[model samples]
Target: MTGRDHDHVTRVMRTVSCDASAARSRLAASWQRSFAHHRLDPAAAPPQDRDTTRLAEQEEMLGRLLHVASPRLDELFSTIGQSGHGVFMTDARGLILRARQRAADEADFIRSGLVAGGDWSEEAQGTNGIGTCLAEKRPLIIHRDQHYLARNIAMSCIDAPVFDHEGTLIAALDVSSPRAESDGFNQLIGAMVSGIASKIEIDLFRDIHSDRQIVLVGDDRAGTALLAVDRDGLVVGATRSARIGCGLARQGALRPVPLRDVLGETSEGLSGAEKAALTRALARANGNVSAAARALGIGRATLYRRMKRLGISGAD
Candidate 1:
């Protein structure tokens, strides 16, 4: 190893073996855990790939997620896989269920233990990209020698967590390569993975709430967030971005809020946005005509007239 690389790993091992509360970042904490809690050998070889004799078994295991995310997976790979890097999708437990690499780098990727069915969870692989990202519940790029194992120093990886229909984290998407340019991995790859993860979440949210009144919140020219409303116009569920867009609490999903309580403006229930906004506003104000009207910035008379036309009931 080069002098700098050796020194870097040595420093990490020392921190990992001691108290690391001063480490504010997740990556630093992970590095500490790799050697301290896990007692993993920092000089160990990279994770080993398992035989794919039962490849169908793994595919069946990830059937629901694969079904929901397959199209976008192809699109994601088509967009990003053609480059020197590769993409891997893993189940919640970090078993690699799918991998896509360009023709030029497939051999190297397979040799690096990125084949389907390989386990990359923290419990198994220490502080590499997929394992650490899954453990920390965040997106990250583990570049070059940042990997805990000496053998993994040649590679860099970016990973993003993917949530299931119930909003449970169920998978991760990893993009990486030994051949990747450091600047590009830092500048663009993380965002690309995050956007793909968000799209999967949006699709999953819609699929789960197909019968409900689902609306995407945000500016039209910009992107949107996914929100699910009930018959009474209560916001029942939202994607992470949607929650942020509507100013909902970050810790737990926000409590059931009326649509109008959150949206700032309203139209006369003619357009989709207007209707969704009015419905939520009326629900939030608890059917009090004047109150709901005032919240919506419309006159009580106008609210009453619109309610009748729109067939909204229980307005006092």
Candidate 2:
């Protein structure tokens, strides 16, 4: 299979789970009661707007998603197999489309009713990273004690919104973890969640974008990119810096460019060698930083520092 094919296959393999039925049932029940059960301090909150009002009545949205979801709800199920992480997806309406956690860590989150079908707006769930990010359409990493609610203070969640072909928000992907783990781990997992959202966006646009040219804009400093690709990586959507690094264009939209070509040459701005070393170490360690550091003959703290310096993140 091709690389893109490989990527999808690997994702499917990594995300398959056996307990999806139980998880779905739990999520549905949670969605039914999230609003009624939640008690927010009105004096400490901000004013609500039109979108917030619409999100308040999400029972129908939840029912639609649960009804249409069948056999294999790939998007919904992906969150469950996140390797000890917690994830939930919400639509533009802020209704929970799905919620899941690694089987090993589901109990604590389940107890808090942070499951599927729940409303997760700042107004409903307080100042949670997921709720706030969705409300504001920004990326966030809310650590322990950062959450507005006392019960949520011990939890950490990193969330990003997913947009469809028209840039309409289709869902929000979030990874929730306990605060005791390294902050680095949370960042990494958040990045992974963003990657998944990006893929979903691509999928949404794949049909209409096949003929349109794309320009790829890479932010070397952030280790991220604004990719505009056709069937193949045709660098059609790119920032000036990305075009300069990849030798594309400066003015109008350019032709399609392959990812291989665009990523073939590492610009002087990016420390490619160091990034490769870090990725290799992490792979060898099976995503365990402490083990990877030992294998690489470095201290765990040193490895974390280097990863942060390199902008490398974990799965959370």
Candidate 3:
């Protein structure tokens, strides 16, 4: 290794060993995990190329999510591609399934192990944008030396975790720049990545539960709070934000909780109560406006007006 490489490695080792306050900071804690749990050397060789068969399997596993994220990836790349940034999407295991980079910048990112099929899990690559975000299950920005590896210290990476319809973390969306940039710029890119990730989750949830009644549980501040309700008014699926905001289960299959139970009858005031009641009635009546109106002791026209006022649509 060169003198500068040795210096970088020395600093990383010292930080991991002597930094008692490392536990308090997310970056330091990740460095600690790299040193202690993963036992990764800051100056270790680049990660090995993944097997093609295994990568294909992972791609297949992420089929639906990949379909939903394709356009968003293109949209993100369109904004950042000319600025020396590369967009990458990795599966739950941190294997890059898809990547987008300008042809001129491709070699640099490839040399930096940012190509498709690269293993970037925290265990494999230390505290990187993709690995650490997946490890923590949250959005993050790892700029320059924030990366645990000396080789990766030149790039800035922003990442956000993508959860499946059941609120299980299924992938990570990332944008990386080899060119040096300010933290402010990195934060901006981070926000864009997070927004795209949320959009992908929302799209995937809707696609998977297309037949079910989708209910927006909270405002944008709640971060895509969406619940998929079945014909019987049972919540069959929820996005990650909805799961967290509504106190639904975070892992595995949801227990088919009632829409009313999840939303709470009085939590959102009269409007919420009315919306839920109309939704339940419509669901029970199989989207028949006349039948649902009769069940609710209201005329069809009145029910239609109420649905329109509540921003509900698609019922017969």
Candidate 4:
């Protein structure tokens, strides 16, 4: 994290905390509706359209984050598996760029072409993660009945907003499934996606503050994280494992700390050369499989298969 990232975190924290406060007040005075049978009808409703001004704002922000993307998104999608859940990447304005789903669900969204050019607005598609997250600019988990559609009541969702160098929202990474209860894997996946967005923001910040020192703290309860820093000692980016391993607090800024000191005993736990090789692969390829495969002397598809065996996602 550079000074800019720190500032962004601080601002976002304040904004969110305030939003929570406001929501609490509103909730106290209003009826707390149960999600058990909640539904929203798109028909007999007011006309709704995407706000072009807002779309433009979000597009500019997204461009910054995408500029530093590792290009290994497809690999990450495969490592996590596209079954039993729906993973999607969207621009800030709620247009779907890419989506992954379970085989059965994939077929459903595929037909609608919602996996590609779909517009996922609460008004257009009814209340959903991709739309609601962009609308509210908040991290949220909408489970089962929380959906605005009666038909969608069987599904659950979790989403987080991605920001850029200027603290502007650029995109959202979200996951949806038919699970009744949120589980450990959901927590792990949500955390991983959030870290990726954070890394992109940090990377953008580094270019602006090339002389400042920053650190990124990550929570590593389940996966590996790839941390990157510039010559200025600022944390430019990190993989899922790094964030979780470090147990980074939400909205917290990481300061420069020696990797050895941060993962002293844990380092011993990860001594296998193969693990090291995979980690190297992720870094060398900027998290891209094709690049990593070329460098590692393996086929692209083989690299994906190997990553599965290694319990790693993306290039790692």
Q: Which candidate number maximizes TM-score?
A: 3
What are the lDDT figures for the candidates, one per model?
A: 0.76, 0.57, 0.88, 0.56
lDDT by residue (192-308, candidate 3, tens digit) is 999999999999989998999889986757358998888666899988888888898887789888787898754677797789889879888999998999999999999999999
| C-alpha lDDT (0 to 100) for residue 268 of candidate 1 | 48
Model 4 CA lDDT for position 271: 44
Model 3: lDDT equals: 0.88
Better of 3 and 4 by TM-score: 3
Model 1 lDDT on a 0 to 1 scale: 0.76
Q: How close to the true structure is residue 47 of candidate 4, measured as C-alpha lDDT?
A: 32
- TM-scores of all models? 0.73, 0.46, 0.84, 0.47
Name the weakest run of 10 consecutive residues (lDDT summed) in model 1.
Answer: 265-274
Q: List candidate 2 segments past 4 Å from native.
A: 1-39, 42-83, 208-316
Over 1-316, each residue of candidate 1 has an lDDT whose tens digit, in order, gives 6676677678677667666442676766887777767777776665485846545676886676687788877877888776778888888777888888888888898788888878887777778889998888789888887787776778888899987644567789898888647666555978888788877777777887888888878873324377788877778887766666777764355588877767865544546655566777878888788898898898999988877776677557
Ranking by lDDT: 3, 1, 2, 4
**Most lDDT-accurate candidate:** 3
Clashes of 1: 3
